[model samples]
Target: MKYYLLALWMWSGIHLANAQQAAVKVLTRAQENRILVRWGVDQPLEWQRANNSGFILKRITIKRNDQLLASPEKKQLVRLPIKPEPVESWMNLVQQDHYAAIIAQAIYGESFEVEDTGEQSEVSRIVNMVDEMHQRHSFGLFAADMSFQGSIKAGWGYIDTEVVKGEEYIYQVAVANDASIASGAGIAGLNDFEPLPEVVDFMALPDDRKVMFSWGIIPYKGIYSSYMIERATDGRNFTAISKTPIVDINDKTGNASTAMYFADTLSNNDQKYQYRIYGISAFGERGAISKPISTQGVASVSTPPRIHDYEFKTDGSVLLFWEYPKDAEAEIQSFEVAVAAKDQGDYKIVGKQLTVSKREFSYSKLEASNYFKVYAVGENNQKIASQSVLVQPIDSVPPAIPQGFKGQIDSLGVVQLSWKANAESDLLGYRIIRGQDKDEDFIELYDKAYPQTHFTDTLSLKLSNKKVYYRIAAEDFRHNISDFSEVLIIDKPDVIPPSAPVFSNYELANSAVQLEWINSTSDDLNLTVIKRRKKEDVNWETIASFTDLTTVFWDRKVEKNQVYEYLVMARDEANLWSNPNNSQITIAVFDWSAVEVIKDLQALVDREKRVISLFWRSVAKGETIAKIEIYKNKKGEAPTLWKVIHAGQNALNDVDLDINTEYQYYFVPTLHSNTPAKAISLTVQY
Candidate 1:
């Protein structure tokens, strides 16, 4: 008896499958809290699977590009901890405390919770993505004398369908709406299924005033080869919607279905709408409605903003901000900010929901992606469109290059360089540097770092006289840099004359004054400038220019109590000026006085240490010099110099052999131009 009862219960449940759908009641939004839900618990019990294949609770989804949502979308896949159920798989790590914003694909990082994990509510794990594979069905519709337009999938195999070429199938349609929300006569499939009936069943329609509608068709065998379909409204009074006779399924030579379907792309959005399918049989019969579907109509609310403001702030952090959109009617929850590289691909969403005021957002941690744009949404709800905002961020540009750079060779074989002006904002002066030979390091020969780019390069005995190369680059006030221009090379000479001499001190005697200078190390060096100023004057006056000096020279006759000043310049065979050297003096009224002159000069001796051949020059070589002296500042000792030479001559190398200690020398040039004295050719090593 118990077995019989169980079998009867199972059969009853199978027969009541469609009735299970009626258990859930659809209610109007106005009466949502008091929804009328019915349960058939005593009739059938839900069987629980011992495995992991049940239900779960989750968050709602939001979609973009479509105003209507189709249940749940992936963006709303919630995360919550649960003990695994199949239907609740979408909920995994998200907990009840986790709050997230709901958004569409367009807005970037927006998400919502899927569900909470508790007793009965569990997060299901995915076993496989492609666990279910459905074989492709072959079918298409053909018009059996305008009866039915058939099938669903691809067109193929038709060898076994025992239908005739002229057999007909009936199609039908109906429309309905919510009784409380719309409050009108709900519609349903009008005409009953008949064997090619001649007229539509108008009385079966619920009413004419309604919002939603539905449609479908039924199949039936026929003998004629022709049929015509008629369409109607409110599932009533007949009227044909199509002008031509659609194909039939029974007469199809290839794969085909005798059923037909119709989709509505166009409808009045202001008012709710519903669509129904219709089919005509060769004998004028119609099928019952399949299902009723409603359109998701929408209304346009606002126009996009006319202008957008993109502000860039250079604080410790670089911030990108924008203004609110204009002409927005509805409150917006977020905006999508896009960024693109300066010279690269399209702008993509970098951030979103920066704010909720329909606009105004900021971004930081910026690097190379400089170009940017913004867009606005009307509570996008992930459906409608996003308005746009446009603005440029870059302000002042970089400084331009210097106007002109020209170089010319002088009679002394030195490069004379000059450049024009840079009129842009706060461009400090420029510096001139030179690279001699091809592989030598560039050196600066200017007195100051920010000197104008104009310079005169006198060949130095210390540097090779090959091609001298140079170029110029600019640095703006903001330290923005311009690259270097092409290089310019100029040729130099091989040799130069001796430079102007210098005297450390001078004094006046009863009728004579003496002068001396620290010597040099160059082999072919000569020439000097003598400067003098008589009394209180700010201007420095040159007394005379003396050339072809041997070493130090002395002047015998002079007036009493005369004060004077003198400076010198050195030169080589090429007549290039080295650097300036100077001297200062005060003479007594009438008295013979010895002048301390030479202080520091150079002396290089050969290995043999014989025949001291000294090389040095003086500022006032011809002036009266009671004596000349050379000195060196050693570590932890008083300065030492060559002995006082009252003979008025620079120190020559000596072979006196003092290898016990290291020694460096300073020489004074006791120079004379007219004296054919073989010029003391001595190589001093002491």
Candidate 2:
């Protein structure tokens, strides 16, 4: 019969042309007397062209007596081109071999095209014609694979009886008088022969009334194109179950499987049957048969056991009870009980070989927590288990108290606590309680128990408490509570900073600034820092720091006429600083020695000229005056420097003075010593 020729197209060790080219494929097998050769075209168009033109066979003897022949001998097997026999000749072979009939029909059929139903579009007609040509090519090649004699008659295969022992020959086949068409070649010799290996990994799975068989396919893909299965009841005499060779068609698609499978229905259950398999090569040769495997079908279990109840005795033992149908007792060989410490843990068989009549089992070795299941074994050793049931022994003793207690509180008032977990298998969880003091009542942190060994608690840092306490207790599944663990004491972090000191008063004496302030009211005050900076300065420089309760500071290092800003900040033991907004003050140092330098200043207003004449007396002692400056201001306005006067002149005329307005005039001197000089003023009206 015709096969699909699926995986057989990908023949191993065959040198094929490029995928873009019309490639021809060839395969060879060596026997004791002769070598067999087969050739085919991969493309449908090439296959049709080859059939119409027939083929020419050529042989070249490349080696003789295991030695290379320098001058090879070439010969043409037939003077005329080889073509398929006439349709009349195929009639005799078609009556005996269905594969021969398939080939004859594919080549010389009445209608070589698919009949168009109703869709007459050009694209549909083209697609149908291409599909029909591919179908013809595939069936013709697949039928040739079934019969060696038919393949030779179809001009696709040949046998070389002229091959000599220890002589290698290369054979080539191509369409007659057409060198452009693709050609195929193969190398074989009488000595190039080895026995094929048996089929590998043959397996059988028996079911109620059917048996599934499978074997490894990928490993033997190059050696065998198909397989044949046989079965027997007596294990000695075997009968072929497959009328034709079985080809793996599933491998034609993507993601091919590595194994091939077949299923056989049995006449009755519980009857032993032996099975074996054979590998068939592309050249119609069968390899060694597989070793026989025996199996018997078995009836499937209708229902599994059900666990109803369980009881815990006072002696620390557990008794489990289950139920099964009484009428199906004969189908059960025995029963087994499995147990595990946890629901999802690995379970082990606890009771083995239990009689079918027994519905209850007593387990003497019981754990604190256990999950149990019962399984019923069938006559064929098939086991069906029941749904698992949890059984915790009657636990009166609670778990051990949590150990290794430790805790810490951060500056943000977040507390973290951790301890060693309890070792009891039945422990449910832990409970944590917190208190601000040892004598105060503790409060539960969570409504339900915490499931982990670590816990976190957020406390209010605004409270007046300085210490916090934590304790943990472990509980079991039976609600048995353990004693509280050791108390964990953690001092609360100092988030409250000390209050700033206020500057009450300050005095300048002898060019020294004396500052007095009230100290911070916080009890944890560590130090007071005094920082000073000029009015135009960007950063402050710490002038002094005091750890004691000193509210007075003498800033003796002072400069005249330079404005200075001071900031007093109080710091606590936690290195937190107080706000400086209420404690900052600015002061300007006055030069007392320069105040008397410009004395006896006078101003005269001339109404007729609309001008004011000013004059000052210069002592010219202890310092030389580089220049003098005159200042003028109205009665309620700020003063402005009116004019600058030369050192020797020491007089200035202010013009355009406001009439009927009282004005003030001041005189200042710029000394060569760079000392600041105070201004002396006189009031005048025009």
Candidate 3:
């Protein structure tokens, strides 16, 4: 009796808990031959308000007789199908309904009507009598629950239930947790319906008088059947042009196939026509029309367009205007503009193609020399361009200022100015301007402009001690002169003294000295002065003065063994003197005695031939002795009858001497008026 009472108490407690209702929402809509059921899983079920795990939406199809069906089979059951996000955690909740578990049962072939609840807001949890159909005999009975033990956050969920069109569906939502199940949250239902799909991507192209039209067919729920092509001349109120529907051979099947196309031979030239397409459903319902595509229905012409006038505006742009050829045989479609650098050069299209109605165009960033023309295009193409208009763009921008200007004075007092040249192609020449004082006005030095990079100004003697300032300017053919170059100020043209002359060759004799030097290389050298001083003297004396061209000097007033020092200097026309650092000194000496005698001597004789041969050597390395003497002596007789020989002949033969009688000979090498040198003797017989 104790166990029985305990069981009775537990049953009472479960009964008391049945009054708690679940807070859920359910909605069902028709799609093709199926029903899509959606629900909210935001609130907890009343049975376990704080401990719910997951939710279940049940769909029921009722029969027309208002009879409630019992225990439907599993094959007759449906599930809520929904696609999930890319995250793996949401896959079970948002996956396709085809893979969804059969969480609800429904009767096949049931027909019913669904009514809207007058209550707009969702139904709140309510207390109700417990339905005994749901039972939890053991903990294992929780196997069919969602197994999602976590709390239900606010989110939406959906499922697709298969059903017949024109049939009604009744859907009910329920939820379960680890402990128990709850039902009767809300109700909603609807019948299945369908409409035609829309047509898209319609296009039209003209080729050889035949207009080809094409479109891509879009289907609603993969049920598009065919398409119809239409045309409108006035761009509105289109009518079908094809006799039969352009069928989609793939028909209602969701697979890629060739797009539908229709070609119509143009009937009238010179007309503008628009075309569109419509998609039809399998039920023969027509859908919305596609966007229109227009084209010109005209034959091709080969004539070129004509240009009227063109000019360069002050804003650095070229404005061009042209007209369609009046004599064109075909309808004008567009006008093309082309430009070239020269009259006979290759041309390139300027900008975008223009409609025949447009007669004016502007081009920017043009070159100084440009030729432009227009080509009138028929429906087909152009054969030749119109006559070109030559344009010489005027230049108003000045050249960059010249830099690196410099000025200097030469020995001649001529001011030379130079500067870097400006690189403008239109540059004519350069001008040299000068100012005598810093605050004075600069005046052009030459009447004509200088074509070279440098100029010279010959200064007058009267302009001595005047500080001259110079600047340069570049001019163009149109006199678009650049600003003045950097000022080159040449202070008073003080004559730069000539470079000092150097002594090249000199000679000194008894009381006489001769000097020679190269002339000064200075262009304005006036003259040269020679100064001299004796070694015993304390001061220098001006010995001579010569003109600028003189290069030699002679002095005769000099004492023997006297050391003399001399310096040469150069003077320019301005009375400025060159440096005298280059000086030379020499001593006067004279030789009064004869030169030394030749040293080596020898002689040879031939008696049978009555001739003597003599040979001698000289120690004088480069100096030549005056002569050599040969003396002959018969045996036992003093040597006499001396004969003279030139110094170069070192050997002589004494012939015709006493033959068979011995004779002696001797030789002496001599210098100018010198005593006889040491002798060598030889005795010989014929």
Total clashing pairs for each candidate: 84, 0, 27
Check candidate 2 and list the clashing pairs: none
Best first by lDDT, ranked: 2, 3, 1
Instruction: Order the numbered candidates by TM-score, best leading.
Output: 2, 3, 1
- Model 1, position 457, has a per-residue lDDT of 70
105-178 in candidate 2: lDDT tens per residue? Answer: 66777544433444233433543555667656765676666677778888888998988998999898888877
How high is the lDDT of residue 618 in model 3? 66
Each model's TM-score? Answer: 0.23, 0.59, 0.25
lDDT of 1 by residue, 1-686 (tens): 00000000011111122333212111110011211110111111121110012112122223223333455342111232112222132123122101101101101122211222231122111111111110000000111112111100000000112222222211111011211111111111112112333212211122112222222223333322222333333445444333333333323333444443322332444443333334433321343332332333333324333334455676533444445534353544455667655435576777766554544556664542345565554432332233333333343454566557778776476678877766754454565566765477777655443536677777654464545787665554445445555677776554444433557655543465566665443555555555555555567665555565544445554445555445555656556666653334543434334333344345565656443345554334445544455444333345566455655464465554444344444443332332111111122234
Error of 2 at 671 (Å): 27
The model with the greatest lDDT is: 2
Tell how far residue 449 is off in model 3, in angstroms: 14
lDDT of every predicted structure (CA atoms): 0.37, 0.80, 0.56
All candidates: CA RMSD (Å) = 30.0, 13.1, 26.0
